[model samples]
Target chain A: MLPTLPLGPFIFPTAGLVIIFGAWFCLWVIEKAALRLQLDAQATYTLAVVGLFAGFLGARLAFVALHWPAYQQNLIGILWPLTSGYAPLGGLATGIVAAFFYGRARQLPFAATLDALTPGLILGLMVISLADFLGGPGYGTLTAVPWGLSQYGVRRHPVQLYELLAGALTLLVWWRLVRGRRYDGQLFLTAVAVYSATRLFLDAFRDNTWIITNGYHGWQLVAFAALLLSLLLLARHDGNQ
Target chain B: MLRTRFEWVILIIVATLLGSAWIMMSQEPATAGSSLLTLAEAPIVGHPAPNFTLPGTVGQEVSLHDLAGQPVVLNFWATWCAPCRVEMPAFQQASVQYNGRAAIIGINQGEAAKNVTDFGAEYRITYPLLLDTDQQISRLYEVRGLPTTLFIDADGVVREVVIGAITPAVLQDRIERLLAEAGNP
Candidate 1:
């Protein structure tokens, strides 16, 4: 895995580069998807931008707060970018709240807005999986498959790639079948259901990650549960239509 | 367009079936490649830390297996690595704060014992600084970079790994978590 790259006069973290590209891609998709779904593209783009800034700010502030004792000695150290300490959960919560309020203030239709944001959100998650692949985290278990990538001196499943493929297929389904949906929530629910179902099946390849007691993969169970719920919601929405 | 409920269900089912077939058919468990696969080949969370013995500065011997029944903070560093140097003071402070409750061992990556001892003396570090002359320990632990610290619970299962220079707050936070886990041990 390529962790870092040296491009004359600057060293770039490969994962960081991937994330930047992914964010740009997500925003572009958000704008285009909004237009396609007859929502206000400019407002949706502004909301996304606001959420991005809020996420970064909230993450850094929460990290500094968690490590308050350390920053007490040198207050300026709170702005130290090299620390790279972030509270992702805090950032995510803040981002969602910011986006929700922005959308409400703009009077964007709730379900339609969700439909517009679905692809971009899924793309963001796909980027996370790609980053993990590049940064050498969340690797899969040992495998005897001929297509298995050799890692750590052994053949292993490319779980991250599998996730990427699953995400791409989900997007494809959204483009093909989710267009001209029966209801506003159909786009969102169908995307989540198809994606979560793939996760339920694919997460079996993962080893020693989020696998709670009884040797059950925790993420797979969560995905299965989410898929079932989404399907129920889909059926309900279908009946409403 | 998959408008009907049956269509969406069929679509997802076909996709999963295709994925399952691909994975199953591609795997050749009887191949030589499969033999290389073991239950726990890589250093991962929830797996026991690989045991190793390394020589410490000042004529002392240390082995990870001996540190059982207590939490462990394994810090891999080298004489170089600015980030490693940046976090040494924090590590030194932590070693003192958690003296008996937990153990923080510094494993110098492929450095001479003299260099390690000199660095320790420079920082006035009181804890043991083990020499990984050949970096065998680093490879065993799959340390990707310097200043990588692994917090292992009392049961010797790796709980978390911090890859950059750690601050006092993070160190203390992780140590507290480790200690909490070691309440019985």
Candidate 2:
């Protein structure tokens, strides 16, 4: 796997590079979408930056708190990044909270802001899937198909590529639906529904899922919940209209 | 105009899909036919353990070949590794519990003998601690990270490999599995 890329004397992790590029591209797309929607692009940019910083800090602090005994023994080890101690759930929750405050402080309409951000979010997901495919992290279950990739010396489904394809299709659907949309929050809800539905189906093929119990993935449950919430919101918006 | 924009979006999406599929198919398989096998290889799990001789803390050279017919727990650790220190007592306990039935060898990676000796004393480690000063043995076993433990059967086949700090219960379970694989009651 292309885990690391060598540039002269320096070594860079391909996954990290892909994620950085993804964030940059996502911000650029968000800025464009904000401009098109007549929202404050600068404020949107600030919100994204603040949310990312808060998320990173929250995840790191949560990780250190979990490994407090080890950090107590060697305080310097707390500074180490890329350790297998991150709490993604904590980061996600912190990011959403940060974004909400930033949005409120900027006096931006929540529905319009979410609609503007949907495309970039889908694109970012696609980039993450690409990174996963290259970095060999989120591998798939064993398969005998011709396109099955060799992971851990066995032919496995390229689930990351599957995710990428799903993300792309979701983005396209969002773009099509955004044109002449009747409701303010329709695009956002539709985007969420498409993305969550895609993830709910594709997560079944993932081998490294966080299983809750009885072979059910925690992420799959989350996806199903998100999908239902999106559908409910869509229906409510339509009824109001 | 909306229909035209929708058509463009569909066309671009199709093109992007075709391009990505082509790139994925054209590129070389990430792990295809590599000469070196990763540590997760199932075939290597049942294969003979790579033999190595290294200087031990007991003031003698210890070789894997010498421990024939005895299930061995080969632990790769370092003095500075927190997980290694955390699991040292469990390893020591396991060593004592299986005193005659199995042999536990701790391979210290590229560390000074004095440091390892001091750490061992602090942890009260009763197992043999071997020093891989040049990391020759670590490289051979593809030990990329600290605190990797390999459970080897009596016939010298590696039965299981644990990549992180293992609890005493897990260690005991793996040892029992290794012994079972070796046909020992």
Candidate 3:
């Protein structure tokens, strides 16, 4: 795994580079989608920027709070070192909340705004999956298949690639939904449903998923709930149409 | 304008495909080889141990290159690893058994110095325990698992790499071979 990329006297974490690039691409995609939909592109861009900052700050602050006692003892440790302690759930929660507030403050249509953002979100996920594959996180279960990638002295299924393929397919589905317009929020709901269903199916191959008792993964349950919610929204919107 | 939108969509899709292809091509060859072959090709064994100066638990900077004439057992471990806990006593025994001839250096991976010192004292470990705060040395060694032991001869060439919990007999056996190699060389 290429954990760090070295460029003549400086080394940067490859995953951080991928995430930053992905965020930039995500913002660009959202702007183009907003323009295509004849929506307020400037407001959407502002909201995306706000959401990204909130997510990053929220994740870092949550990590610091969790290790508050340690930081309290050594202020230098808290100030100087940037360790891998950010929580993904905290970041996701903060990003969603920040986007909601930004939309409300800008007087933007929530459904249409989300529809414009779907492609960027899927593409961002695709980039993150690629980063995970390269940086050796969320590794797959042991497999004897010819395509298995060697990790920790064992041939394992490349689940990160599976997630990337799933993200690509979801993006295609979103593209089709956008082309064949039905309702205001149809594209966004369908995108979420496709992505969630993909996660529900592909997460089984992941070795590091948190498994509850009875052989069920926590992420699989979350994906199922998200898929259900999206389908319900789609159904409600179809009835209105 | 509609045609331009379609073109943008096509461009995005094509870029995504190209990016995925590039990532796969770059990663597959490096990780596709057999695990044993990958371990062999790793820049660890048969190469000189990467030199680093780290703060030891005893308030001194310990550098691997400074201890030139003695066989060094560099074990990368963590205080919380169960296998590391199981193997500590064995390493402690081996340290005393080969007092002047070999050096047993325990490199704790990314833990506070206080915790490592407490654990070392609890285990009655007499060897020097160094703190790899940023885990730079661990990354340099490509140590994927805990309790990874590298036996370096007097010439600083890494001779053997042992993963997982090690017994006193096994540690002694490897140290004996390392000492033998050093003397003959």
Best-matching candidate per DockQ: 1
- The deviation in Å at residue B60 for candidate 3 is 16
lDDT of 1 by residue, A66-91 (tens): 87887899676666534457788889
**What are the models' TM-scores?**
0.80, 0.65, 0.61
Residues B134-180 of candidate 3 have per-residue lDDT tens digits of 99999888876677788888877676566556555456657877888
Candidate 2 local lDDT, A9-78, one digit each (tens):
6556577789888988998888888887778888877787777778877876676675565457556555
Candidate 3 chain A worst ten-residue window by lDDT: A76-85
Model 1 misplaced stretches (Cα beyond 4 Å): A3-13, A63-74, A81-84, A212-216, B1-52, B109-115, B133-145, B152-161, B179-185
Give the TM-score comparing model 1 with the true structure, all chains together. 0.80
Number of clashes found in candidate 2:
0
**What's model 1's lDDT at A70?**
78
TM-score quality measure for candidate 3? 0.61
Please provide, for model 3 over A1-241, each residue's C-alpha lDDT reduced to its tens digit, 9 standing for 90 to 100.
6755768865566777888899999999999999888899999988888889899878766766765653564454443434344656788889889989989989999989989988888998898898777653466766899999874456778999999999999988877767787667878888887898788777777765666554457777777677767765665555556
Give the lDDT of residue A19 in candidate 2: 88
User: Judged by TM-score relative to the true structure, which candidate is superior, 1 or 3?
Assistant: 1
**Model 2: fraction of native contacts:** 0.03
Query: Could you give candidate 2's per-residue lDDT for residues B1-185 as a string of tens digits?
Result: 22344454554455345434433333333443242243243313544688888998879999999998989999999988888887788789888988988999999999999999998898889889999999988988877567878888887767655666665545666687677756774
State the DockQ, from 0 to 1, for candidate 3: 0.04
